[model samples]
Target: MNNDIDSALARFAGAEPHAGLAGLEDRVMCAIASRSSSSGLAMGASLSAAAFALVLGIVSNAVPLAEARAVSTLAPFGAPSPLAPSSLLLEPR
Candidate 1:
């Protein structure tokens, strides 16, 4: 095993240096820049979506407990949902 290792080392020492590929550095740099730009856009979109969700949650939760109870009491059977115009129309006496 020692002899094999020595022979391998000797072969490597005698080998010529490898010529790197042309424009490899430029291509790698361009790929990195494109990935970075795309990641930045993705990060911005993710943050925007998170903020929108948070604001929506806050706004939805800001309703008073009494108001929530009142709304629930008004539609206990889930009929005539809140958005139905018929629910808001008052019957004439």
Candidate 2:
């Protein structure tokens, strides 16, 4: 049974190709090449956009921003908290 099936498959595989099959490989290859070329263009465009954003970020950081200052003077607090070790050491034993 295996030999019979093998012989039948061999006969089918040995059959000649049809006329419409001509240049099919070339057409398929051309389609694949066109798709790859479009993807390459899209990749380049995205990379260009990323580079522009990076440059913009660097340039913005290079410039100095405005400085902020306190509007009113600060008053002195009476003493350091007794819980602090330094304050405890300063006190008479």
lDDT of 1 by residue, 19-75 (tens): 777678999999999898879789989999999999989987886455433534446
Lowest lDDT block of 10, candidate 1: 67-76
- Candidate 2 Cα outliers beyond 4 Å, as residue runs: 41-93
- Where model 1 places Cα greater than 4 Å from the true spot, the runs are 20-23, 45-93
Native-vs-model 2 lDDT? 0.84
lDDT of each: 0.79, 0.84
In angstroms, how far off is 49's CA in candidate 2? 14
Over 1-93, each residue of candidate 2 has an lDDT whose tens digit, in order, gives: 579889999998999988899999999999999998889788999999999999999987887586768675544466555556777788898
Q: TM-score of the candidate numbered 2?
A: 0.36
* Model 1 pairs in collision: none
Residue 21 lDDT in candidate 2: 98
